[model samples]
Target: AKQIDDLTLAIIICLSRLFLHISADSKYYQSFFWIAMSLLQIHDTKLFASCVHFLDQIVHSMSDNGCFRGQGLATFCASARKGPSERMLAKLDQLSGLSFKYDFSFAVAGHLLKGLKNVGTKAAVTRLLNTFVEYSQENNPANVTGYFAAILPHCGDNLSESCRQRLLSCSETGSSVFNAGMVPDKIRASLLFTYLVTILKSSESEHEQLYIYKALEEGAHFMPDCLPVTFDVLMKKMEQILVASQNDQMLTAVLAIMNCVYTYGLESSSPVATLNKQYMESIGFASLGSADQFNQNQKGALIQAVCRVLDGFLQL
Candidate 1:
């Protein structure tokens, strides 16, 4: 009976989170969100984990049942890499090692990816990446790239180089020769790209920023070949930011990234040049007449940064 109450309360919190954050049609979700939180303030790790798992299932059900089909999500399945087995659950029943099994679904993976650097023990990170790599080999490779995007920032730095290499090799082949699945999965890849760059914008660590920049710089080289739609989405992100961004620091960091990639293309002639030019032309940076709103100083700073990278990124 006590366990039943916890599950009942958790389901309510789950609904509150999904609807409240996904859309803002009413204030009830907001009120319920806090109310659920206050109710959840307890020391029971096991109960918390169970509630989270149940919450994941609800979101997954919504996705799988065509609730968010208009939003372009094919399914809301948790992108969990490895789910706990009966044995594992039984162990949890016996002793309190971890409060609950962590969800590895793609949505959860994005959050986990950001926190991997802080996760204890190198072996743990290695095991997760290895599991992801193994899953990629068996399933659609592009799906795994979502997980890859999360991990790439910390890859290639002697931290997870072996697993990183495994990921690159697997992506080279993908799940098919024609990549029929990739075509429909573009939205997922695009959202993953957005998650990555947006996180970079909010991050305060210079070291992490460099890793993200370098990872994106390299991804610019390969996206066109493996995931063309995702490449377009990333370019759109840049163009959108360029035209609308008022934050000088953000604009500055964005330009540095552009500079790194544009510089990369100058020497290597990577396809980033072609895709970037198309995306820039689409934005019509040369005729952004909306700059009248920003003061002269902000406009000047933005224009200089845009022009510096545009000289090479744009077509003459």
Candidate 2:
């Protein structure tokens, strides 16, 4: 009997998550949803956590509040899509700071993406993502990660693509949408590049790293068009990495990112090529042999390899 109950709970959880994507109006969906919720109260297994997760999703999407929110948004956008609503925008306004507090930033991003076709949806997502960019410029470098996840996935003429276009246009103007409390535009740009290359450096394999960097550069092509960043913005970031290159892991990623920028960063010419000389001269990559053991030998071979980028070449 106990085995049967556990099996019942497992099946209910699976159905809830999978069928949650189905039309909410369907009779089977309504019936299954209640069954899942009821089972959630009875289940005491460790998997109850996952069951609660699905239940939270169900509540967010199917509750009367979501419907009310969706309806208000629909009415606001009804006059041929001018923009998002004051209330919906207010909800979005709370997203960046709140999601960080709850570690639900990505979950919120995913939910918005899922609802891109629903009422007030695009404006909600695009607005929130834009705020994240603004946030990254000032305090949360991780905001860049959220920003990328919002756009890098599959979707049609959706909010993600729309946000991408808006950002691209905004980047061209070298203007900021964020207010006074945010970080300087240059610092935001630097943090963005650091986050990008750091992820590439953390990849599990050489082949994976290559694939990741390619994908990263493709995302980066959108960078100059999305934010107030420029080649000079990226160059400033590269300089930061160079001065700190005694961390061998960072140096490898830095070298690869420089090549990506040089090869795929910009259309005409990237100023990143200039960072090579700056890095070669930094003590982080060099030695006063008599000065200190750690300083002289730390990442020594890597220093030789990376500094060669200043010579205008990619080496093995």
TM-score of each model, paired residue for residue: 0.36, 0.26
Separately for all candidates shown, the number of backbone clashes (residues 3 or more apart, or on different chains) is 6, 3
lDDT (10s digit) by residue, model 1, range 38-90: 22222233333333333344334444444444332212221111232223222
lDDT of 1 at 86: 29
* Top-lDDT structure, candidate number: 1
Q: Write down the RMSD of candidate 2 (Cα, Å).
A: 19.8
The RMSD of every model to the true structure, in order and in angstroms, is 18.9, 19.8
In model 2, the runs with Cα more than 4 Å from the true position are 1-52, 59-201, 205-208, 224-256, 260-316
After the best TM-score superposition of candidate 2, give how far the Cα of residue 224 lies from its true spot, in angstroms: 5.0
Residue 9 error, candidate 2, Å: 14
lDDT of 2 at 316: 9
